[model samples]
Target: MVRGKIQMKFIENESSRLVTFSKRKNGLLKKARELSVLCDAEVALIIFSQKGRLFQFSSSNMENTIEKYLEHGKEEETTTNNTEVQQHVQPLKHEGAFTAKKIEFFESSKRKLLGQDLGTCSVEELHDIHIQLENSLKTIRARKAELYKEDIKKSKAKEKFLFQENTRLRKQCGRKPNQTPEKQKEIASCSQRTVSLEVVTDLFIGLPPFQ
Candidate 1:
């Protein structure tokens, strides 16, 4: 048979309230035990009567379960606190941090390279900076020379292609072709020089010192 929902109110009579509390407390404990056993879950429940009577249940050792619960709660609290701190601190950039110090060091080094701050540098440090500048200059010059050679090679190839086209056009127009063997030999020699330049490495190419 279907029964209407029970009214939600405190039991006013002292005897009825005690009986109700005993029945409901036992029912709740039974439910907790069933849940733990049926779902293979850990469950704990604690009850206090109006007279300060204590009732408790646990799927395992009650002390151990309570300790585990407290530990888990503390960990969650720590995680939440850490998240809040990060959220607030990130917007503030936590000025004067390690990363900020590193950036400042890099900027100081850059200024030194630009010759803006030399008062703090010693003679040995100055010599090291000078060596660094020399190495950088050599690399820059090497790259520039490589690009210049490439441009020259491309220009020569384009010139040769255009000359061949001009010769073909001249023959079609019944004009004497001006591509003589000497001109062809000069073009071939120029191409060979470009190829030789491309082969030249940045290594020292001088005779050994005399003993």
Candidate 2:
């Protein structure tokens, strides 16, 4: 019995998809090994399932074959026709490029999850990472802004209370015994310093120490 050509698209049925994947994967690996042996060529293959399963093969030591393949690839310019054969023999080489990117993404994420990113990343990678950080920073900044506003409101309230208290104290100072002009000045200076510290701490609230 003969089967008609299957359409090139995602298989909707899980059982059929698995069966096709298994059959094609086996055939692809078989062809790869045969080519390597008969033609005395090096080969490596790598496949990742949509479910993230990995399958791989090599003719010789995988590393040596991969290195040799890369060196040879540099010497030859492969077009579309040759590309099909090249991909068949060394699918890993193609997949490796994408895998490298995926590895970088995961490594970057791992660093962030572990609190070790520390703002060190390449420009392009940093760009994507920046979005995530910017969103986090936005939240922090909003919260910080809210806190600052609240703090400022409290400070204004305190200032109004102090102003009224000072007015009362000044009225009393003239009448009260043993209160001096120098002590009033010192109290005012201490309050000013406290306000300055609050402002400085508020400025530092959402910023990283290094940046």
Candidate 3:
């Protein structure tokens, strides 16, 4: 008799599930090691079990592999951003321009902004460009001021909230607060009394003195 192929579904029984996990985990690690040895490749494998038990393997140090992966990802991101350079300018007065004309306009404007190919620009065009730059600078400054004000407002609100919370917590815990009129009032109104816990017998049955 030949063994049947196992179905591709989760094992329901706990014992069977654990056995399968152990076998597969070892097999996967063995394969990773074999591939790294056979191909001289840098390989990193990480596994987390249902219980959060971690297993990892790396051709080299795991930390070094992680650093290399991060560096490579960063370099790839930079390259992708560098490849997606687009030159956009404000739309021309004639919105019905052809695609080629729009592209030409954008390229020309980009060059002008970069201070290149300015020989063909007339005095009026140069003046217009100067006005646009001045307006752009004004807009940028306005936005920066708005952001600064918003950030400062948020910081002030946060500081006020934290101080209030600290005061409330201190009062709740009956702890002395920083020197202030309220702290002085609290200290002044407070009084301490010694508590006597002695017990006296009140079961005396003897006759009292005759009146």
Candidate 4:
């Protein structure tokens, strides 16, 4: 008699669930034991009840069987990782070779640009090289103009900062907010005299003492 396929679903009733769990757990352990004995193989099984009870079976010492299983799993994982690394490395190796070739080509082109290796170029090639050089020169000129503009901007900012600092220092020194031309000339003369005095002091510092 052919038995119809069972429609599997979760047992919602607590009592029915417990009964099914007990029956299935026992049958699974029995089959594991039978397989271990008949085939002379290491077998292990583990189960957990809904109430958090532990059930387990092993053909030999459970600890040893579990340790061996864990070791086997680690070995398989290591092999898989090594394979993946090799697969990834192969493409990188190919790309490295391609990059090296590209760099060599650019170096050769640079030599041609400097007129160091033009013995093999035809007329058309020479004309193309001339156009490339002209374009490169234009680009360089544009870059230089941009740099000059940036430098001018920085110089203007520095000048403004220095002017503000001078004004602040003058105020701190009790200088009049408005200075006459005669007062400015007097200030400049005083500054020159102070600098000369500092130089004279420095020159005499290393002089020998008179006996």
Residues 126-175, candidate 2, lDDT per residue (tens digit)?
Answer: 67666878898899999999999999999978876776777687777785
Question: Backbone clashes per model, in order?
Answer: 0, 0, 0, 0
Which 10 residues in a row give candidate 2 its minimum summed lDDT?
175-184
RMSD of 4: 16.2
Residue 90 lDDT (model 1): 86
Please give each candidate's TM-score: 0.47, 0.33, 0.39, 0.57
Better of 1 and 2 by TM-score: 1
* Predictions in order: lDDT: 0.90, 0.82, 0.84, 0.90
lDDT by residue (30-132, candidate 4, tens digit) is 9999999999999999998877899999889999988998999999999999999999999999999999999999998999999978999999989999999
* lDDT per residue (tens digit) for residues 33-66 in model 3: 9999999999999999979999999999999999
Model 2's TM-score against the true structure = 0.33
The count of residue-pair clashes in candidate 3 stands at 0
Best by TM-score: 4
